[model samples]
Structure formats: structure tokens, C-alpha cells
Target: MGSDGSSSGVVREPLDYVGVTNRTSSGFSLIWDSPEEKYKNFVVTSKDVGKDEALKPKSTNKDSEDDSEKEFDNKEEEAKYEQTNKSESENPRSKDENRVPESVSTPDPQNKSGTGSKPVTGSITSFKKVLPGSSRFFQFEDLPPQTEYTVTLLGKGPGLLSRLHKLVISTGPEPPKDLVFSEVTENSLTVSWTKPKSPISGFKVTYTSIKDGEPVSVSIDRGDSTLGLSQLSPGSSYEVSVVSILGLDESDPITDFFMTLPDPPTDLRAVNVTDTKALLLWRPALAAVDKYAIVYGSGTDSELRVTVSANAAEQQLSGLQGSTTYTVTISSQLGSNESSEASTSFTTTSGSGGDGDGFGDLQSKDVTPRTARLSWKPPTKPAGSYRLTYQTEGQEVKEVVVDGSVTELNLSRLHPSSRYTVQLQAESGGRNTAPLSTHFTTDCSQELLNGILKSGEVDIFPQGRSGPPVMVYCDMETDGGGWTVFQRRKDGSVDFFRGWKEYIKGFGSLSGEFWLGLDNLYNLTSMTKMTLRVDLRDQDEATFAKYSTFELVKRNYKLIVGGYSGTA
Candidate 1:
């Protein structure tokens, strides 16, 4: 090595790079960088210096190298020399600073030996060799383990004196044994090993994933024989190798394999919840896992688990009790080991609105030829509203929305003797109650009487009027049952019996509602038309003068009127 701007000469012109490389216990490799210009020859010397020789003060008498050997022979002076050498290296004189300049500097004397022991400068073997400049490596074989060695290099050039290069290096400790898993967690693991019998600097751990690529490595202090490995893959197997490092070298790698449990599932949540069923959704573990287990139950119920395939993102849980709260947990598994569980809880909604047996005691009353009245008792659980729907046979249904309190409704315009079906239901909370249905038929007596009167023979005033007949309203119940009319000829005969039915049928347009002149009743004296007011409830026969529906035929017909009428 050359001194910094102090000494103008060069030692082998200073190597491009020079140190120990590929070192191990029992042996180490010494390498020196080749120079730009090749040398004809080179020499490597390894000296086995005793501890006493290395610790003794250097010979201040430049005249005698033999004085250095003599100082090591005296035990008491050797101890005093050891202390003085330490002080001189710490506060070196200007003369010593000028020797190597900044190219050489001592390590901290406090850490002169790594474990506070006196550091030696040699191994048991001494090697000296003169080899060609082509040589790049010198392997010092079968050296003592954990011993320090001082190596010197010299290169011979043309017309140049070979210069000396010095380096000190130590061999590594022995390899560790019986490395194994001491503790494990989801994302971390602890590895333990037997401490090497020989001293060591630290432990170097290199781990490889059983599932993927290149091994990862780390270094830890020697005091921690059991070291924890973190940032490890969950649910994965790995092979880890532990090596002991001494000084700047490492021992052989000792390997052990281990597996870590998978991490818990993430982003747990629930969706599509119902009274009796729910769907649970979650994100699968990022790492590889074999399967998943889903466990769910209410606080008061026994929990149950369902196994699902890996990569599944959701599960449907059914048969849940209505209006209940439940807790659910999701866990991922790799073989028999399962990761810590991820959990979520939710409450179900109340059961959906239902239809019950409402609208009871349904009936139809006050039946008529064309109308009916319906009534019913309110249901036990009255709803917000009611729907009353009714229909004749083969007709579209008609419905009325009513308050729940309404129990009676009038259904009108029904055909005589035709059957109608009525349905009733309660409505509450946007739901419909069970329907109560019943059947009803209108009274047929009115139609039967109407037909009888219509079938009678027709009689006309012989003016050939083809237009529709004049109209009149009939109270079939009162008029037809009593069956009377103010029908009589001037000659007084029962022949007006035919007039009761026939003339009444011609009064279809209500033309018989006006007054009748009894002063000259039935006078056929140049009248264009005539009307009759009739009421037959007086219990009269065919000769009755005031009947509800009465009729006749004659020439020059004049209008006549009787009972149930006002002034003309």
C-alpha cells in the first residue's frame, strides 16, 4: 500500500482490491487483485505469530530486530509492553502517522478482539510461496479454527524491487447443528439452534419458500441463538438454513423446514339479509389456503360450521330464526391448521306481513232484483283498510277500497235471479289479509211478474204507432201481488181484464204518470195521446179506477188518471 502524499513510492502499486474472500473454518482463501501490468513472479507469506510476539512492543532499536524477540521472553515486561502498545496505537506519534498515511488505520482498540479477548495475529500454519503473476488465489489449507493470520504479498517486476502488502484475517467458527422451529405464528416464526462449540460472530439465516423462488437471507447477533423470523408468508412451508459467522467469514449452512398457518380472512361483511336467511360475503386470504370454514349462530343457539372450497367469496346461511341477531366467523385452513377467525354480526328483520283469516261472518242481506246490501263482522286483527270485491257470473270483478272500520257495503245494479260472488279482505302494512268469500242471488219474483204482464196480447188505438211505448215505473212487490187496476168500459164488463196487462205493457216509457180526467174518463174524443196514473195496492180487481199499472184500447183514446197522483 502507498502512503497518502507522504511517501512517493508504491507497494505493488496498491492493489485494485485486496482482502479475504471465500473464508471458512479450518481454511480460508487469500486473494490479491492483479495489476494493470503483469508481473513475472509473486510471493505469499503467512506467518504463525505467537500471542506473546504480537502483543510485545515493537523494537524501538532499529539496529536490532532481535530485540523484539527478546522482549517476548520476559513475562513481566511483556505485560507492561502490552499496555504501552495499546496507548501508542491510540495516540500515535507523527512518525507512525507518516508510515502508512490514511491508507492504513487500526480498528477500535475497545473492540480489538470481538468478545473482549486478546486478539492474536497468526494461525498455526506458516505458508510461503513464490508463484507466477498469473496466480490470483492462494488457499491456506488445514489451518487452526478461529485463529487470526497475518498474510504478506510481494510482486516482482523488471528493474523494480518487490514491495510488501500486509492483511490480517480470521477463520469462521464451526457450523451450527440441530436447527428447528421453536415457535410459530400466523405471520412469524422462531428458529432455534445449538450454539457452535467454537466462538462465533453472529448467525446468518437463509430461508426459501417451498411454494416459490430464491432463498431469502438475514444476519442476527450470536447472543440470540434462537432468532425470530418475521414477514413470513402465511399458510406456507419453507426451508431455512442457519450458519455461524466468525470475523468476516461464514460456516456451512444448516437447514430445517417449517410451515406457517394461514392468516385470517379479511373484509368480512354480510349482504342480502332476510328474516330466515342471510348471505355472508368476505374477501379470501391473499396467500394460498386449502379451504374455509364458516361458523354462525345466535347467542342462545348452538353454533354450526360449514366447509367451503378455497377462492369462494360468499356463503348463504339459511334456516335462521326470524327477528334474531346472529354472529358469524370465517376462517381459512391449510391442512389441519386454521388461521385466526374473522367475525361479523347482524340482526335479521321482522317476519314479513302475512294474510290471516280476516273478514269473518260475511253475509249478503236486503236482496232485491237489481241490488243487495252486504255486512260482516270485523276481523280480530283489524287492518288499516278493507277491500270489498264482487262480480256477477262471467263478469270482471269490481272492488271498493274502504276503511277497516266499514263492515257494511251496498252492492247495486245486480241482475235478477243471477248469482254474484263477493270477496272481502283486510289490508295493513302493505299486505293483504286472507279473503272471506260468499255467494248471493237476487230475488226472481220481479222478473217473473214482469214477464207475465209482457206476454199478454197487444192492443192499439189503430193509428199504427211503431215507436217505443210510453214508460211507467212499477212496484212489482206491492202492485203485482195486489193485482188491481181502474179498468172498466162504459158498458161495464170484465173485458177490461185484458186491458190491465196489455195497456200496462204499452206504458213502458212512463207516459202514464199524468192526471186522468174522471169527469169524461175514457172519452174517445179526438185526443192524440192519453196517460194514466195507476196504483193497484188498493186491493181492487179488474174494474178498479185507480191502479198502479192499468191499460185499455179504444178509438180516440183520451188520458185518464187515478190513485197516487197530484193535480192535473
Candidate 2:
């Protein structure tokens, strides 16, 4: 008898051949030849080796059974099946033991034949029955990717030992995971992903522009996990897909969406500035945008941000501080994406008298013990009149109005050695410009006989009452008070090694280290008999040097002293 357990002359195997065809990531097909003799039916079973639980056989519907019986009735279907089988047979990998026929009995855990035997267990399985003269082809569906499956086919007949044809096949690789997009710009973007654990030869990447509906594709080696795409439109959207690939197989594509950055606004500038507001202008961006974002602030201050319609070419900023410089930045935006920033700077006019106005510089000259002359340049814009106000701390403010054509004023009745703040404003047609302000101290000699004893900066007219005021430091507490300080070196905040011109005009602040001008020194010493006292200190130690008489001659400010006495 042959392997089919038949008494006939020579019985052939139930199936001549079994091979896999139409393999995919999720499913595959099994094709076999017709048996030598007509059989009641054929039983096919499949098991996933990676799974442990036994799977119940699937019930075949009457329609499916009828379809299977006539599967091979169509000549065209037979020819297609033959072609598929031929191609699979040509592949050397198809000749493995998995594709060869074997002799085996179907296991029945119930032992329905009353035979003493143990049933097979611990395997997930699915079963299908095919009638004789059927298509000789069966398809496995809805299987996991990158999984191994064992499929078996057996012929059933009366009083016959059916031979089994078994084969092992695996689905295609799984798709990539955790896809990400980064480093996006106006014209390019990057995409990356985590490769699947399943073995694969490479990947296929495809991206489509949502605006134009044009797709671009690229192939990448399995070793690479990232790809960079360029030449994209700004402010545009895109859809990307990644698929894992193996020999003659590709996984379902993983898809995602992203956007490119927009172009920034151009030619940003400040068009106008006032004490409380500013107007900014810019050109529109070349790319399409939904809006524009504006950010403005002064030095070290918290910035304020606002947005305007994309069609707007100018923005008005309000509630700003006067006489302060501010920086403004503008950027174009589309959806969640924003473009690079375009920036500019401007300064606002003064808000009030306390803060100087944007008008011309104000100066004080011809100062005396009881009078001062204040002068300024005319404002760039014409004014109807000018208002001048002056006051000292804790004193009532005084005001004076002058014709707009006048730029200088003389004030009288000012206290000797007293500091006064003066404010000047230009008014025209009921509107006034921000005030221009300055401070000045009336002149006083550094002597108790002059009725001045304060230790502070003071204006002195050493060349008599007709000359401009010369500011100097008076040290009233030392040597019975009333000492004029010509030179001081307390802190290193000021640079002393200066050119002759700087020295002639004096280069430091009276509140800090300073040198009284040489010309002032010559005029002062030439006016009165003065005593010189020098005090020096290092860390905690101190010393002094004094001269009973001191004076400076006119030529080159030559110094002369007599009767020196001190601990130095």
C-alpha cells in the first residue's frame, strides 16, 4: 500500500506539493495539488508558535463551503494559481522541510475511535475543511506581523491513512514606532523614529505637501533612524509616512503631520514717538500668515506682547515711559508656527518736568550769589510761547512766561549757595511739549565770612561777579570749616590719567573723585589768600599736611606755599 493507505495498485500521496504564495505582513496563502483519488474532504489547521493558548477551530458557513467546492471550476482561477505556485517553486527557500509532505494523523483529544491514546494539547490552533476537487488553495487571514505560523493539510477518506503536508511561514516585518519630527525651519524639517524589534532590511519614507498634494519618497537603510527633507514651502503643512521593509514585503505605513516655519516681517521701524505712545511700521512677509506678534520693552523691564491681523502693516504701542529708549520686535505667525523676528528701537519724549523732554539742551550760566541766567535752543517745531518754572526743596515754586522767540532768561532773588530745579516748556495752540529741565546752584565763596557753611558742591565766581559760575566742592567740617577742595582721590571710580584738554575742563563728578580745573584754581587763588590742607588715608590709617599760606600764579598755574605744618 502507498502512504495513502490504499489497496489499489499504486497509491500516490494525498497531496503532491504544498507551497506558500502571496505572502504579506499580516497574512499569506497556501497552494497544493489535487489528490490522486476523490476524497470526502481535506482538513487544514494552523498554529501560531509564539502563542500558548489553544484556539478553537473556526466554523465554516454553508456559503463558504459551497464556494470552496467550486474553487477550481474556473479555468482562469486555475491558471492564476498555477502561475503563483510556479513562482514560489522557483525560489530555493520554498524547498525547505516546512513545504514538504509528511505522514501524520490528526490529533483528537477526545479519542472518538475508542483507541487508547493521549491527545495533543498546549497549542493555539485554527481549522478549515475543504471538499474534494476544490481550488486546492487556502488563505490565512488577520495574522500578526513578524510571526511564525505552522500550517498543515490532510486528505480524509473511508478506510484510508491520510498524509499531511505541513509548512512554516512568517509574516513581514512590523512598522516603525515612536515617529518624531524636529529641527523644523522655513524650508526644511527632520523626521525620526524608533525601529521595530523585528528584523528588517530597510525602510521606505514618503511625505506629501498638504497644500499642493505632491508626494516625495525615499528609501533608507535599516541602520538609519532619521531623515531630513528640504525645499519645502514656508508656513505650509505636510503629511509623512514610514514603513518597515523586508525581502519582497513592506509593513503598513505609520503616518504623522507637521508644519514649516513662516517668513518674518521685514523693514520694521518706528514711525513716530511721543511721551506716552509710539507708532511702528513694517512690510508684510512673503509667506502667508494668520497674524503678527509684537513684543516691546525698555532696559531690563518685563516685555509686553500683543498680536494684530496679518493684513496690518503698522501697530500703535501705548502706555510707555517718557524720555526712555525702547526696543520692539515683530514676527509673522501661521497657526502654531512663528517666523524669525524683525526688530527696531526708539526713544520717547519726556513725560513731565521731573524727566527731561526731547527738546533742545538747557544750560545755566552767569550765575551769582543771588541771580542766574538760563538759556536753551529753540524746539525743532514752532511754539507759541515758553513757560519757565524754578524751585528749591520745601520752597514754593516760581513761574515765568516768555515769548517763543526768546531762548534765554535772567532770574533774580535766588538764595546764595542754594540749588534750584528749573523746568522749561514750549506751548502752542493749547498743547505743550514735554518739559526740558536743569539744576543750578547760586555762587558762594568758600569762607565763613560769606555766610555759607555747608559741606557740598557749590558754584563760585572767582573772577568777580561778571564771570560764569565755576562749580567746586566745599569741605566745611575740616579745620573749622570753609575749606575749598581742589583735588580729591577717594575711590577709583573715575579715570584720572586724562589729556590736557580734559584736565582743563575737569573730568570727574564732585560727589566722587574729581580735579578742579586748572583755570578755576588760578582764578580762585589769585582772588583770595587761601590755606591749603591735604588729608590722606590708607585702609584704617590717616595723615595730614597743611600750609599757612597757598597760591597759584597765572602762568601755567604755578603753585606757591609757605609755613607748612602737619603730621604727614
Can you give the TM-score per candidate against the true fold?
0.35, 0.42
Clashing pairs in 2: 476-481
lDDT tens digits by residue: candidate 1, 229-331: 8866677789999989875667867887888988777545554555577777665674567899999998645898899998688898899865566788999
Cα lDDT, model 2, residue 235: 77
Q: Whole-model Cα lDDT per candidate?
A: 0.56, 0.68
Candidate 2, number of clashes: 1
Q: What is the alpha-carbon RMSD of candidate 2 to the true structure?
A: 28.0
Could you tell me the lDDT of residue 17 within candidate 1? 49
Model 2 alpha-carbon drift over 4 Å, by segment:
1-23, 29-43, 47-144, 147-169, 273-277, 300-302, 336-340, 349-568
Top of the candidates by lDDT: 2
